[model samples]
Target: MSLLQRLIARPPPPRTAARVAVATELPGGDEVDVLWVRDPRARRLRLLVSERGARLTVPLRASQREAQQFLDVNLPWLAAQLARRAARDVRPAFGRGDPGPLPLRGQLRPLEWREARLLRIEERDGSIVIQAPPAASDAMVRRALRDFYIAQARRDVGRWLPAYMPGLPRAPRSVRFRPLSSLWGSLSPSDAVSLDLALVLGPPAAFEYVLVHELCHLIHPNHSRAFWREVELRCPQWRALRAWFRGDGLALKAEMKRLVGP
Candidate 1:
């Protein structure tokens, strides 16, 4: 190694694990640990590194050599992730207004608001509609929508749980709402359901569809044929409804953000 290289002490290159391992390179140092896992059912190699650590989730067929190559190629990405985590760890505040434009459903939109009671929805005869109170500023409107989704989840999630899952013998232990980036709702195996607050700002039908989808999970955890059949039983045209949600209902989140300003 050159004098500069030796003095700088380039962290050792990541090493590949054994063939039995899913395939990923070893982390350079203890500052950030790495894990490799092979999933027979996985279609492709995927990497997930968060505040906790880095891990490789890849197809079982991937060889250790391939895993190591993948890790080497993604070294810069992994290092950047570590840096981001380090930065976030020192973040100063929480619950800041306008968490900067967040994605509601699929569209990215700005969230702005003030305090008000009226809940209004506006759309220019298109896929996305803005839901907020006229007097309520953008921030307040988002807050209202957030509150609305939470209240609705409490009422809606439990109603369908027992109906769809008769074997449960009792109502779901708890139902709650939070901001979820990707899904409208999720059902936990432990009888808990979490609703995404963004849903409250979505169309009424979207809310219903989400309610139906999540409740079905109480009985069927996986997206198996039986699970879809259950969803169909509740909303015969659920497929079409979901399509509408993807195309239209999902955009309400963006609409709300844009129309409601800081």
Candidate 2:
């Protein structure tokens, strides 16, 4: 290996001093402030951009020069992403007692709130009615609401998974759902499939499409051409659904975070 690379890879001696903060100038002349972190478990440098800001994590004892170089290379791409996020209109986050229609099942369903002895979420007359005590805490309401969303997501998975099982070599070891920041679905090395629970709030077709896509992974674990062909054969509308996500994925995730995430 090259001497510089070897120097960056080696662990620092005990009692080494912490490095200064890393910041770089964006093309528009604003400074992109980075939260630099050294992680012992990290295998390579990773950049995370979120509502909070940018975070750069590097392998323990990696040289600041290497980290800075990495950040420099990724700056343009980061700038573009930040620009997209900045340009999109910002929607206010959902909060308790807002009584606004919710983004549900590809439609904005009217949401009605009422006082009851206990918290409950029910669907009726093409809308959702939620009941809670006269003084329910926001945390309590959010928790109950998140549970409701999870149950709904599972119902869709239960309905669609059986149909896709026929031609596949075997069923997944397990199927699970949860909130994922950046992925719609993932297949673990153990063949378990986990999907983002937020999908239940979108169109049913998108939910079913994601289910089929993950089930296809039981046969081909990687995204080789053969794998995509299998996907197309199973779900003919896969491409359109993919395009749908490209257009609406960010908003959907943002909605999920607002409604259910802590």
Candidate 3:
């Protein structure tokens, strides 16, 4: 063969498939859908378990057999995680009567509900009192309370940004509040900061830490050493605050979910 023909006839480099699907039976006879994804950036096999099921990400050179073996080794852990998620999915009811003490600004404040002509909320003598229309539905009352929480979070987080990062290059484009499921706060590409309204129900320190964490993201987009160093520079006690969020924060989220029903 000519030299040009020989060069052109060489076989193409081997490439792993982008994604493959498999199924595995759990200990309880439940079948879980496993997606095997070939990620060039993946350094090792990683398992992501969620309510949607588990996904196994492996390096491009890894095999399906290796993926199955990895899942087999971690079946117990996966089962436990699925069990925990199932427990969390069981929603609790929030009665119309006084909902008891609620976390506010790092303390538990008694929550009182009253019916009136107008919707009003007030913090009186370490208690949060809500007054709404006599005929308002539970959803309406919950919305009012949720809005109140958003207002509080907006005020506190707005005040904190300046105090925490006095040397920030520029003020954030905007600060928004919303009901977020799995995040405390996020810094958007448009330079806006979105905070979960539920954060107001956690400890004040935790809220502050979340604010600092997101603001640092404005500088360092990833969770690299530089980002953590910035976080430490702003909130030195951030680890303890994070621990509080991981422990007590779950209770706060559950309570919020119970009250809001989502």
Error of 3 at 80 (Å): 7.1
How much does candidate 1 score in TM-score?
A: 0.43
- Candidate 2 lDDT (Cα, 0 to 1): 0.76
What is candidate 1's CA lDDT for residue 104? 38
lDDT of 3 at 190: 88
lDDT scores in order: 0.54, 0.76, 0.71
**lDDT (Cα, 0-100) at 197 in candidate 3:** 67
* Per-residue alpha-carbon lDDT of candidate 1 for residues 205-226, written as tens digits (9 for 90 to 100): 5677787787777777777788
Q: How badly does each model clash, as a count of residue pairs?
A: 10, 0, 0
Sort by TM-score, best first. 2, 3, 1
Q: After superposition, how far is residue 224 of candidate 3 from its true place, in Å?
A: 2.3
Q: In candidate 3, which residue pairs clash?
A: none
Tens digit of per-residue lDDT, candidate 3, span 135-173: 777777777777777778878876777685575766678
User: Tens-digit lDDT track for model 2 on 38-153?
Assistant: 66656578776654556777777468688878988988867765676666437555657877787678988899999899999877898888898988888788788888888778
Tell me how far the alpha carbon of residue 117 in candidate 1 is from the true structure, in angstroms, after superposition.
Answer: 14
Best by lDDT: 2
After superposition, candidate 3 runs with Cα above 4 Å error: 1-95, 247-250
Q: Report model 3's TM-score to 2 decimal places.
A: 0.69
